[model samples]
Target chain A: MKKYSDRDSLLIFIVLIFFFILFIKLMYLQIILHVKIDRVVKKMVTKNNIENSKRGDILDIKGNILATSVKQYIIFLDSKIIKDLNKIKMILFKYGIKIKEQKITEFKEKSYIPIAYNVNIDIANKIRSQKLEGVGFDVRYTRHHPEGKFLTHILGITDCCGNGLEGIEKKYNKYLLGSKIVTRMYRDGYGHIIMQDKLVDQSKMCGQNVILSIDRNIQFIAEQELRKAFDKYNAKKAICIIQNPKNGGILAMVSLPDFDFSNRIKNLKILRNSAISDVYEPGSTFKIVTIAAALDMGKIKCSDSFYLENGKLKLGGHIIRDNHKINGTVSLSKIMEISSNIGIIKIAQKLVKKEFYDYIKKFGFHSLTGIDLIGESKGILMNLKYWNHLTLPTISFGQGIAVTPIQMLSAFSIIANDGVFKKPYVVQEIRKVNNKITFNILDNQKLGKRVVSYETAQIIKKLLRNVVESGTGKNAKVNGYSVAGKTGTAQKFDHKTKSYSTKFYTVSFCGMLPVINPKLVILVIIDEPKSNNYYAAAVAAPVFANIAKRTAEYLGIKKDKYEIV
Target chain B: MYKYFLLIILIILSIFIYLWQQNTSIRFAYKVSNLQTKYNKISIENDLLKLKINSLLALEKMYSIADRNGLMRPDGNNVVYLN
Candidate 1:
């Protein structure tokens, strides 16, 4: 009996050892293979919870929000998991959403179903509260331009996906879309967060804010005057750019026939910013380069007299006529004051072709002005090899070459900045979304490159002042400001006749107020006005005067030319 | 008996620590999530107010309002400047 009991005990011991090994193997699978198996199971039940981070804001120098992002929601359908389709449809109907039966069946298997986006929080929360199966909620941010149509061309617009398609918005898109993250959360068959990662700073995902050098008051004044001229003249296009000549800061820039950011674009032509993209003949305003070059090189003197050819000079089978007729020889300064094209062309004839070409390029023409905006055009200048006998004479009077208004403004800015060329920029600082200014223009202290001798710039300024005070630019003078500027009226090129058209003209005026220690440099262009008066003096000068006057008053600029009673 | 007593104490302490850590992490997560919700609300409010301010300061809107109110520009004779 004892032997029989021992045999039974041995069998029982072997069975016990087998059970113990099985238990150890099960524990190993649960602990060691846990993460790998959990991921696979989680894929079936887990969904990514994305935090729709806000895009950065764009503000004026004074921290006035021009462009911002608002919190919104995106409601998507999950037809696969939907329990009560009719009930879900009824709940979403009040929030401007409808799910067609056929459409739901068509995408019945799809886990991710998009229904409506940009829904406000109040409505979104109401829909989310129903907690109906298959209905999902996602946070989204919508871009807002608070100033409406103002600064449209500068602020630009975004695509449906919130990507900046144009202007400053497009330029700083990367910085604005900061660190939007998608996190994994596990839930049961019913959508609920079982386990989730830690909450992060949602604001950190927002893009950095861009602060522009544009002044709201100054931009308003410029836009108001430019719009008035644009409407009154029935002009095809109008552009006005205001710059801080001391530091190459663009204060105000307006291009008319402009589209509103709030409205969908119907015509693509309105998207083109004429100030930096469209090229036009600079007319007599380009004479500054000729005079400055000659004076700088000691090739032409201020007192040097030139025969005016009795107001007309025949060159290369083309007659170049001066609008203001002057008899006999006139001093160089008188030639500039009268804007005698023939006299200036005669002076240009004295310099070598290469020297004249060198000076034209030296004045920031036929090249990008390096402004912060994109799609800048390098104005047309024919290579010296392509320059015919007439090219030099026409170019001397600003007829043959084409130049962008921003480039023209920068050239004038060089003179105002005491012959130093500082690159023009619209962005003044980059800040955090919370209005903390990070990168500042004032802190940069960028040194400017010398473009001309100070003596030459002073001479040109004096001549420009004479033009405004006693010459064609007299209309551009302010009541208590000593302004200096040049007037230009260049005929538009007609492709049909292959010659300059008489009917259409681009009248422009580039100038600055408080000539000595100048505060602002302004450029105004009116393209193809239908009015009887198409002269730069008549069409563009008055606009400059009004904008400068209002801007000076708003900025409280000192009146440097006041007379004592 | 002494060894068995030590083992029981160690196991209980370990289990207690594990439960405490899980409880603390989950509790702090809820707090963080609540704060995030409040922050998002404030940010939305800030943006909406800015939009309102911008509309009020809009140049065209202001001009139209001024015109409607029968405002007149001061003449040169009436205008004064502060030095």
Candidate 2:
């Protein structure tokens, strides 16, 4: 009986000891480890969701959509529960989606796996309908150009990550790429943004929409005419710009050879916007700069006479000859009308070197035009101290100096704008998602800087008008519009020959309509024309005429001449 | 003693109602979460469709099609001014 009692006591003591150990473990788990366990549970239940803000839309002045973003989905899978991997592959393959078979299978335990990216909405819908248990989708944005291949260089292309890489896309990337948002959402086992709380403002995620001053119709017209000439001449490159003279708004800009932004580009050269990126000798088109400077400085006048030296001027051991020779004495108007190189050289000789350099700077040459485009090239200009005997006369005739297409257009626009230089820009306005103006450039402010007097600009305009009316720019003359312009045919410099190449030429035409009070300024340039005629009057003027005519008609520009009073 | 037994039963009934209400609230929250997800997806789909429509109606595409069909733009002489 004593041994039985002792055994019972021992058993009781062992049972109590086991209960105490269990109680201690319960206390540790419920108190000390409680916070840690709660965190783990929350992490399992909550999803770290990243909602991408939609990139802003690019719209023309008329609210025409040029570029936009569409919601695309990346199809993913949880290989853990993929019942019948072959079945999933079969459905995906039906919709033209090809996925690597071995990758998902190898990572069978991965909760989230990417199957395909940028699956279009139509196919994504078809995929969601399948209701495959483990398959999932994550949303993303794909940049879409509504205008297709048109304005490729202007609107530029976004990379796979929806970041702008060139042109306006790069220039306004910060403004266009809205803020990305991250939300720790409490999702129900399956990962998703729990919208029940409505905590995140999706609208704040969107970048600002850019409203460009570009007129789509005008851009199309310029692109069409420029492309026609480019193909006809088999030119290496071509550029055209249409600007509003009154306010310096760039209405249309076309550069070719251009690439389709929607397609993957192989050659990066096609992405360059040549209108602002490339520089070439203005040739005869640069004569306007000489005239404007001469007239502005009271050094020369339309009525002033210059001895052509029989159309050949011997200066600095180099005999400079004119394209069209005029013997004896000729008026400044005649010099411009005939596009005589000697005549312009004689005029440039009248202005001092310092005066010439100052005028060039005033005309917005040798510096950026601030045209709201990236990669603007400041044309080559020699320092005044480096000017030799031949530099002045040579530069006067649009040789030995370089100017971009946009710079030459601005010079012409100053004359049309009553001698006031307005900074050229393409972006008219930038609005936030809520339609509030963030950056507004479409103000009524005119005359960014006074380049020359109104009287001097008028005299230059008159001479330019005569050049178009009955001069070398006759092909550029639009019917009943009173055009004013200059044509350029510059020899491209050959690095191999260390001089200008005879075979390669850059033909250009920069002009404005209704010279009396111009509204539009248009410029066209063709590089390395392989056609029989490489003259600016032949290759570039006709293109200018065609584009200007179409643009005027589209914009309802009134006929200034041949109207019955 | 019988009254106290009745009171205990009443208390048990009230506790059961309270628990049922809490359960209903949780179920409603789940429904709300699901509805929110569906709404977001639909909105995205709607935006995508709108973008597609705009692309299809782009002027450049229309012009290309018109050119293919031998349609030439009318000259300035043919266009009558309305204003």
Candidate 3:
């Protein structure tokens, strides 16, 4: 080595020191702060994107779309990235979206400004094709009811976030809401996103579809006829329910004063399904229960005669009078034919109070019908211990008791179904998005309990048929079909006066088509009819006859009544 | 010397294969992404069409149309049984 002076040696030492310092800095960066830097870079390059699936549909029995979810877009703007505001405005205007001056001003301060909502895919696609910078779209689903006001009470409504809020939507929400999937994506240098895996099949992740037992045609027919009567009488409320007595499937149910669900609901009270939620004194409809019980329990026979105290009798410090006066004793069938209140009261006296109450429970009164619906009432039934002498007699005439329209329909169905009580249901099946049936009503069908003997049921059917043939239900006669049913006109009880209102009455008719082997059970109730005539025979019976005639023609039930040429 | 040379060639080939696979995977990812977007657009169009069909065929709408056209429901006596 060559010997150097002091200056040269100092230069060499400084150079070596500089190299050592550089090495230390490199080591510190690669080890000590490595994890922090790596984490920051990863967060910038990778994204967690949440993918939303569409909600399922609700269909009628014949696979008609009753309710569905359509994919809509929320057109938003990234204020930070948006430039050329006029150009964006021009592009949006081409798609018929007029952004107000105030809204355009709002776009500057907010990072994300939602310009429009519920934008159709076609319009959204047109705007997106313009390739305007700083414009983004957020996908959303909006519920749609295609049938307008038909089945409003059953289809229900949903919230803005696509959650079911009422009716069938609320009862089967979990099965109707689809899954939300989170996926990991990588961002390239050009800002293009690269998915880590193949895109998921959206239909597989979608919610299960619900199918109801309601027939749209039958519903339409019932709605049309019931609405005519409702408007004609200017009734406060009207309800109609048609059921298949064999399977307990509700074919059609309509409640009047229905609102269009597509519009904003101002009066939420109308949302209550009066057919299942609201209760009324069933009036003469409950008489069927008493007559069936008496016939079944051997307390009275079809041939047994009861004296109708000259159409009036004093009982429990109250006077019970019949609509028709019959002084002498008449057969059980004749008593029901004339709908004699004193006749039914005399018949009810034969059974013990405990026995009558037991029969009522067995008929599914004072208990939830176990219908797959929301807000079902078991009706107002006093317990055995609370029963006064008036309770038994009043309940016998359908006075002191209350029942929902569905309960009354079901009670009559017991007679039509050969005295077997089957639980009424609207939801027929639950199917996957792939059309694979996951739940069927038949699979979960409960074996009907026997409420009366088959013979007793046959006798009641004949008696009901006689009522429609030549008695109070004569107005309910259909041309080609044999109708077996009863008429009820119950006076409304005034709470303030503690007496029955002379002006207000609930007129109803519950009947079955084809007396023997009944296929359809229909019940119609017109509450507080404001028309000149409010009798069950005049108001409710005519409506029932019209519905039965049209429904029978549409269903093509063979004509049981033949006219001799 | 020959065995060492063969080992080096094998390592080089393995690295080439690995690089080829990575490139193909990225290309496939891009293709899949494009296809997914097309599928979403088509499905949206299909849903809209289905909704349109249902709305047009609604019973109330059909009834009104019939009424406007003066088409009445056939009476029971006029209809003959087919079966």
Candidate 4:
């Protein structure tokens, strides 16, 4: 202090200057970077949210709900905010929740931690009332199919984020799942957090509620009948489809063993829609298409007759035989009634192989039915270029080719609907949430193409009716209405053995009613029945009869012929 | 003159305080109203979802399906188990 030299004073001034610069820098940070720093700090303290919109409800035609969503809370813990670990543990234990030590240790370093998800409102309220600090709850919407086991393949399911995971849910996910909105907020001096006014328009964002063409009662009936057949025959799988032939509206489509929408599926294979997804050699059931094609081409008249080749006809290396081989010539109508394999082969030979192949293409075989569904299959049909002499003959008798249950039904629908084949659809309309405004009918434009003459269709229907009355399909005959349909017993091909497995059989029956003027067409399929009966008449015919009879009566379609048993 | 100046400053300060309080109360009232509306909306939505769930998962509906189809509860002897 005594040595007051000029240099010393200069040094002290220099130090003061340095100190002033540091002070300026501090002020700059506090004022200039205040907004950014505040944001970072708020991010550290504020609650984060993953936004979601209300999911749409799937409804039957009668306004019955099939699927909808409910808000479920995911309880979490902010490890940093939790003042006492013991307290959090106590609250968790009270709610029957357990926290492993490893989880707690792992999340101890994290600011936010998830403890449990999908807790119901009651438990969420109880947790909220505890008012424990650092405990957070995220309210999210979860999908729930109220009809847990009914229409599982159609209603489909969604993921935790409300994304459609399967079925119609997957097909129309975007239309069914509306838009989600997210907002950030922070507490003020009074602990009331004000929202930033970037209001999202959520009204138009939520998925529009869909109304399906399915009637709940009709679906129930179809499912019940299918299930009874499934259990009675000890069938490995079963499917039933009910449709309004006039507009190609699908009323009920059930496949078993169907999964409960509410339960976690152990095996996903069972979830497949067998009616549209799985293809089988249609067997005798496919004779309908071959006959329809033959009739449409005018290659053979309804009165056309063919010799049965004396019960055994050699076509290439294969021998074709009938179930009830009548060793004589039969009329075209009797050919259908007896299901003569040789008779169909003879008729198929009438068309040039190219014409026969083209007719098969026209009937939508080896092609999708364009139905409103997922996982549709176009069954295998070799092109005319690869057609061998045996190919045409075998295919004529409903073998050496594959077709889905839906394709067969749609083909028959063309005949039942008087030749105008309308594409099948499941969804009917979309409705708004706030108001009762229906948006639009699903695919309002009709896609119809005439595939057969009205006269040929009428003849085919009569021939089918006779099959139900006194032929192989007698089990499918209704009490009051004259039913027309065919029975199919197909042998499934074994991949490893490279031959057909007699142990595995696909039994199916497809039919329409009122013979002259059909209103509905029903198809039932039973796969791998183990009840010691492999015939379609024993396995699938009764199922079709029950579903058709009850369904026709339910629709209040009066019988044309009032006959008592 | 000193006394008059002091009185003017006091009047100005009092007016400013009154305005600030009024603005704060209005903002608080708006927040409460908004929150109340949100709560009401949530309640309505919750009710609607509940009704939909009930209608879809009704026992009568399931029973009708079972009855119409002829499905019955499996007997102990008929039930098969696969590993």
Whose lDDT is greatest here? 3
Interface RMSD for each candidate model?
A: 2.7, 2.6, 1.3, 9.2
lDDT at residue A448 of model 3 (Cα atoms): 83
What digit string (tens of lDDT, one per residue) describes model 3 on residues B1-83? 99999999999999999999998988888778778878988998888889889999999999999999999999889878897
lDDT for model 1 = 0.85
By TM-score, the best candidate is 3
Write candidate 2's Cα lDDT for B1-83 as tens digits. Answer: 99999999999999999999987866876777777667667867777777778788877788879999999999666788887
lDDT by residue for model 1 over A82-198, one digit each (tens)? 888788888788777986777667776898787887777778777778777888887667888766778888888888667888889887777666665787765545654555565
| lDDT winner between candidates 1 and 3 | 3
DockQ of each candidate, alpha-carbon based: 0.45, 0.50, 0.63, 0.13
CA shift of A484, model 2, Å? 0.8
For model 1, what is the alpha-carbon lDDT of residue B37?
66
lDDT, each prediction: 0.85, 0.87, 0.89, 0.81
Worst 10 residues of 1 chain A by lDDT: A191-200
Shift in Å, residue A498, candidate 4 = 2.2
What's the alpha carbon RMSD for model 1?
Answer: 3.9
lDDT of 4 by residue, A256-353 (tens): 88887767788988778888998888888888777887888888888877898778888677777766667667898888887888888888888888
- Candidate 3, number of clashes: 0
User: Chain A TM-score, candidate 2?
Assistant: 0.92
